[model samples]
Target: MSVRIDITGLTAERIHFAPSPLAEMGAALHALAEPAHHPGVQGWTTSVSACLDPCLADRMCEADFLWRTTFSDVFTPSAGLPGLHTLPGATLGEELDLLDKLSDEQFVDAALEFTCQSEYARRDVARLDDPRARERALELAAARGSHQVRFTQRLLEDPPAIRAWFRELMQDCDEAFFSDVWGRVRHQLVADARLKTDLLRRKGVADALSAVSGSVSLDDSGRSVVVDKISVGHTETGSGSLVLIPTSLGRPHLWVLHRKDWQPLITYPISSPGLTAPTSVEQLTLRMSALAHPVRMRLCRHLARGSYTTGELADAHGMTAPEISRHLSVLKKAGLITTRRHGRYAQHQLDLSVVSRLGGDFIEGVLR
Candidate 1:
């Protein structure tokens, strides 16, 4: 469930963080499909919902075929961003023009490859023939639902329509949702890139990447970087560089895409108030402030035992519920804890991975 990237020959200069409108569009679509995964982007989601054509919004929210993992690659091709090292300077019209140029054969081939990667699709499409694959594709499609099955069948029968549908979705999102969202977050995205650059200048590539998330870390041998929550694993022995893209859109999780013909890319969430670790000095200072208090330290230790409600923590600490609530809020803001509502009561639990890393990082910073 992790990707072990072998960065043996990669230099700090080779690692780049750039913004991508195509990547942002893909992230926005993902957020729309699984709103629960991105609680921090509720405001953007609401704005997107309001801007989208009612039918399109409903399809984005309620349709399974539209949100399928295969469709992400299908919709957002690498051609949109011809240069991997910088924010794609291409206009939306240019990007869409590139998408429109894709041949029907390319669409069909990519779709088949994507479908084969799916667990359900692989089982159904036992043979490689188009007729058999098409027949079985319907069975695979039916797994998502009957409505989607027909749509999938049509796409399989007429590959050109797949391109048309993808273009339509992108056009809708580019005009309706992505333009506004990107305008609002572009500054933060640039700031995040600057912070990473500063970390590279002050610390090193290893420390800069480690600071990104608890889920990303250097191995004991120091030859590999392991990214958690990814099912696929591969070693890059080629001479290609690694691209690191920081985006406000891809919050709450990191996305990795590897291709032999292109630089391996990692799109991670930039630091934000309610999302993940703070990468810059100001943000880090605020996070470190949470641990500066003794009462909060005691509360963190207590929560480490197990999840507890505000009243339960108050009773254990001999404090009022409001006092415990304030302490919990600080811990939550520091990314050291998470709270979930269970009926009328809320349960709080320590994020042990982050807490342990913070302790180790503090010690290392002091010793150095």
Candidate 2:
């Protein structure tokens, strides 16, 4: 119910096999599936671009593109992953050309193929309630050394209560986020384009959006499934193209639905095995948190040099005794710095050993 999916025994390639002649389009699906090919997966979408603040989508696009590009560069394909080399159709170049020149009809075919496969593929990504699935998928995608696996395995073993402490924004996000109605709103827009429908009269999207025109079919369980027949309009005129934009919304896509019928001209698949870098998430969450403030980071820096007592630290930081105490209290809560009372003035220190590990991870995140 919480968007959790098992993904226990899943492999990334299984997604392309079903719902399409992926073996024939095998070249196509595999080309599309990888992180390298489209580093823009989470940033391109047609839905919210139509409604949300225009600048909002663009700004979001810049930010997500930055992260995804950075993340994609480091995502080494799993060595044993099935589709790494089983490319069929045209070379990736050909497929990319096809992607750019893809018609409304073609887009429908691919999307239906993708969705059908995703129906099964999602079973793996979504069914996972365990965050370890995320951790493992990340390890599988970003496998570097045994230490990563061992470390992640150990962290995964920790209970969820502690895990949940790490939040995305360090603050609460409301429903306007891509999770609730807006998510569906964008989804409907893309689905409309993908399904290429004007009315849910045929499909079940209700009186939602409409589609362009053209027809597309994919091999569904060895059978051809007519995904759509719709015509689509391009937002970027004279260019004959659709642009995909990914969003921060937890939902998996940002897309461009052909206005003619509603076929998705462009879709950015934001969800993936390594998409949830648990360690990075943890580090980012902790670091981004304004626990003690800039002054606190300075304090932490000083403490890392060596520990000091409350009075000495307060005088050094040029803060009053109570003010410094408050800062130390916040740092303690953040698990960054700790203090122990000695005589009248409590000794405050960087909590070196623990902070060192945190610093190591912080460096790792930056490296990643």
Candidate 3:
């Protein structure tokens, strides 16, 4: 549930915050595919999805590579824009140039490795040797109708065709969606990068990282940083500098990339006031609806004390677990509470800041 980054002997200079235009574009495509996960970009998601070719959009949505692992080196910090300060100033032409220069081998290798990194692929071919496992991985990938399956297979069979398809996909996204979306979000990305840079300058690393998100924190050992993610946890030990990228496109979650060769990169949501502000009128209606019930209010009050499992709350209230789970879901979607899994059960806790903000916003609106 968390990725622990071991930076035991690293200095402050080792941590760098860089924004990427292409990376944001990749994130935007991700949001487009999974719009429900990114409430902040719902409007853009709809707009961009409408712009994309139906077949292409479907393929993008079906791409397990994009959704599953950050193991894809093609989206790494060094892959797109060159320098740390280059992203804010990068143009679409630059992204295209970088994409054009990407070797066919890098794309094929990343795609295949992505398949191998998946839980299903790992499980399917666990006992098999390398060659057989890779073949089985491809079979499983193709059976799932994965977006990159055809491209990956073609790379081994007809390399030129795979390269052409990859280029075409990149060009299609860049021309149809990325260019305009990047233009719209570029200033915000730049502002976020500058803000983080200023924080690093004034407050040092720990305070700066803490400011980004509550889920990001320095570990108890003070020798590493822990990122609260919902994926398989791993410990990476190396002497590489850490790159912290603030992305406007990837919200509500942190994307960590830790490969053998590349610098450890953590792309987290940008802490912009407006970006993290309370929900819109429609969203407020949903939150208000979720809070209107007596049982849910009591649940919130109970969680205010500390985190509680659904079973515990159900037992305390003499209600069924299913009923409690439904209530918890409502509260969670309303941003009133957060749930983290521990073993087999999920612990739900009230988000005090969100509750306070909701109250303040309600009071101000009523007064107005």
Candidate 4:
């Protein structure tokens, strides 16, 4: 199961892996499989299905080149963080020269607006399964005049309600829901992979910065990651114009451009550039580290969708109540997530900011 293949369009009847050369050429990939990095081993199986069996070796070579030219260039210097590979620290304090380059007119509508709308779209999706979420989505849709389909608006307005409806529709949705959602996102990701621009147009970075702006000052851990603000403005045609390049502290070579031929404004997170980019590095690290614990990690992963109580977490993760409580205590302490008192039950929900940070990094790391 480590490898998957679908060579339907290719002339090859079967694909074979050159064990020695392939393994030797892919040490970085193997390194990525280390438990300390990405937990799911399947995430590291960099497989490619080619049409011609004869070209399998060549394809593997190409895959190796891609892995090197991409992941290694970004991830290595970040020092084993699974998310965004840390950019070079040496380039710190570099003046945000891109702002100077931009003539006054080029900077129009704030990039924050688009990033906010996009982030809202994502958050809006999460509530799709919940009835309450659906209602909220509809309200927002009405307010914003998104005019998405009424049903779509409903789904968007009340995610919790919609999610509950979806569960009822699908019946026994937990198992199938993840697969379906993953398929949706992965399919879109794979399809987008065909174009080079898809890698750079990472909508998540802007979203992360939007969330970060909520913070007044980031802690020491947050300081390690630099996020420079990009001056965004509206164009005469009524579209967003990003005057600066958006970047991650861990990534190099990959800078956020305007998705067009605009000037590339390279910037850093000297102090969280904006609200989307939270000064919660300490919270992030602490939360991730707390989740790193096998029991809690499994619990969090298992509960990615539905709400779960302490008992469910304990039962699912194979830990005692006391131990689970300890982990939960750490998680809440780190502000990675929170617990709500629901009558006799206490439910845990992952903080959206933390989720955005991790998600933003994951998107940046993989897409880049």
Clashing pairs in 3: none
lDDT of 3 by residue, 170-242 (tens): 6677777787777777788778767877888898778877877766778777787877554444444355567
Considering every candidate listed, which one attains the maximal TM-score?
3
Residue 275 miss distance in model 3 (angstroms) = 7.1
lDDT at residue 284 of model 4 (Cα atoms): 47
- Candidate 2 regions exceeding 4 Å error are 1-283, 341-345, 352-368
Q: How far in Å is the alpha carbon of 66 misplaced in model 4?
A: 24
Taken over the whole model, the C-alpha lDDT of each candidate is 0.63, 0.34, 0.65, 0.34
Which is superior by TM-score, 1 or 3? 3
Residues 1-368, candidate 4: write the lDDT tens digits. Answer: 00111112221111110111111122223222232332223333333112224443342332232233222211111211222112222111111122222222121111111211333101223343556644554554454334333434443444444334422322222132223333333333223222213322443232333322232212243221132222222111012121212222212122222212232122222222233433334444565677777766766675567677889878877778888788778878877676778999999877665665775554433322
Native-to-model Cα distance after best TM-score fit, residue 220 in candidate 3, in Å = 3.0
1-368: candidate 2 lDDT, tens digit per residue: 01111122222222121011111122112222233343333243333334555544443332232133222110111111222222122222233332333333223222222212222112233212545444444455234345434433433343232123212211111122333433334453344333332233344221211122111222233221222211122221121211222222222222223332221222223333443322333434555473437888887777888778777777898899888888777777666776677677677777766655665444433422
Output the better candidate (1/3) by lDDT: 3
Model 3: weakest 10-residue lDDT segment is 120-129
Which residue pairs collide, candidate 1? none
TM-score of each candidate structure, all chains considered together? 0.63, 0.28, 0.65, 0.27
Clashes of each: 0, 43, 0, 62
lDDT of 1 by residue, 147-221 (tens): 667666666667666667766767776777778777887778778877887897789877888867666777887
TM-score result, candidate 2:
0.28
